[model samples]
Target: MTSQTFGVQDLTLTSVSGSNVDSMTQLHDSYDLAGLTLPNRVVMAPMTRVRSNPEGLATASTATYYAQRASAGLIVSEGVHPHVEGQSNPLTPGLATDEQAASWVQVTDAVHNHGGRIFAQLMHGGRVGHPDNTGGLQPVGPSAVAAPGRGFTPKGPQDFPTPRALSGDEVVEHAASYGEAAARGIGAGFDGVELHGANGYLIAQFLSSNANLRTDSYGGSIENRVRFAVEATAGAVEKVGGHRVGIRLSPDSGIWGVEETESRELYLALLEQLSPLGLAYVHLEATTDDDTLLALRKAWDGTLIMNPARPGGPTPAGPEDARRWLDNGADLISFGRAFIANPDLVERLRDGLPLAEADPATFYAGGDRGYIDYPTYRA
Candidate 1:
């Protein structure tokens, strides 16, 4: 009998091999999550690749790309629009129509075949999108506000238009759409779904004081402002089991003019509401200090996945950072750009191998040049 090999390159000796294992204490440990026993605590965070077809369908290349990085304990796919109005950019994938859902079966099958658990991240861009990018349809948000700055469209960069405020009835309908999308994701072979309620997107827009200025039941007061996110999460949980659902939130992140004047209170209140839902996990983007993060961990009584890096930070999360967070309280640590270049990230971290640097130039320009061309470590 022979052991099967599973990386882009054959295993080889690296400078950090053998000696670095002791430093990765909790990072190398296994944990049971929502009935699934993950091999490790490393998670591949969701990232927009903009590599799908114009029809918002996943291509063969998408399956190949995800299969290459199946070594991660779990893989959260790039932000995928649950509906046409939720699409934020050109060439991003969606789970709206049957064709789009069917296209993802290949990608999911590829990951499962490689012993990987994957979750589809459902993102609604809201005002962050432009008509030029969403097939001439006007973007809609909780309020009629335009996000600050320009957005990249198919033609080029364009100013974001002021989105139409959804009526109370329409808000309910939009929230229900997330449930439909979650059903579609499960049907398409995804293990679960993660609602993108962060990074100044639709859910975050509703939670922001600057972006949401409405006086309706979905805005104004803290409870009202958090109503939309709560409803969206409930809708997703209703369709898919709570154990197969998760939500991502970036508290206090002021991107796209989404200023949370009362972030600490806002998130704590939101978590109090969501803690009883029995959701799979809560993924938080670490934009604040460690004390703040630990405070958040103490508040939420569920599995927490923390991305331990500020947006546009100089350094990416390494094994040391992972161990620190895991030791502190985080059940899982997600890596974004590190997984982009190192498809075999799990093995590299386990054996203490040097990681290849990713090219920033081709991060989102499409094609496979920077998508899947990076080689694994070798002798």
Candidate 2:
């Protein structure tokens, strides 16, 4: 047994039984996610397909796409905005309306009937969007700062505008939106909901030092900055219960201009604040170092779903990456792009078969070409 340094807090990392075939077998084994029983430990991490219709409704292909990947222990659906104002880009789905929620029923039913548990990841883009992409509604964040990049729209890429700063009251409302979305997701037949508290979206903007320049209780110090994330998590737990709710966090990910000055201390404080809610799991992206990840894994009391690659990064998590993470204290491993090209990812890994590669061209806002046309190896 190797003694690992967690943090200055003296938390220790307990080594896994070992890696290699043992890890692979263990990963494919069934486990309990809160009250939900997952058939394997491979999680299909949320990847925005951007194929939603103008009304933010998911189509039949969406159902087929996810249903094909039903072999995953958990399938976290693409980022769905809680409201139109929170929409990050064009053609992304939403969980805000009754119609949108009803639209997801088909998707949830598809995955469930195939023996897969699915979770809706509620994401709000914050300052990282353009008005052209948001139906003329300006994106809102904790502050009025503009993100450093362009956003996708029907007219092609457009400049990201300085988002309208949410008033103090509006800030509170936005925080509650996650819980509201979680309720809609539950109503839509989802097994659970994972709050998108990562990747420089609404939650990340509030957690960012440079992005969130407000002096209110929602920003400034580490304690203050982590407040919105805590409230969002609490809201989800309030609506759907803690066992059905989880959150994805990127400790030091600087994506979309969100930089955590003290990634270690910030996330530890966040974990401490969220521990009381008793969420089903905390998904951590490999956007930071192993030491910080180990500390976060130690600090989080519930399940930890580890993504072996950085959020929105180029790399895809493979079996070897998953094995190493399992050795490093990750309960479940998430795969992003790997799951995109390989619907039968679990079967491939379990049988030691080849993993398929996804085409980057048809990744977003397209027909069924690259979306659902990926064939199983046996096919």
The worst-scoring run of ten residues by lDDT in candidate 2 lies at 1-10
lDDT by residue for model 1 over 1-379, one digit each (tens)?
Answer: 1112232122222222233323433565787889878898889999999999999999999998999988888999999999889899899999988899999999999999989989999999989998887789999998888999998798888999999998999889888878899999999999999999999999999999989998888888899989999999999999999999999999888878799877888888899999888999999999766666778899999999999887667766766667556666789999988888889888888776677766677888999889988776653
Q: Clashes per prediction?
A: 0, 0
- After superposing candidate 1 on the true structure, give the runs of residues whose Cα lies further than 4 Å from its correct spot: 1-25
Worst 10 residues of 1 by lDDT: 1-10
Q: Could you tell me the lDDT of residue 5 within candidate 1?
A: 28
Q: Which lDDT value does model 2 have at 113?
A: 92
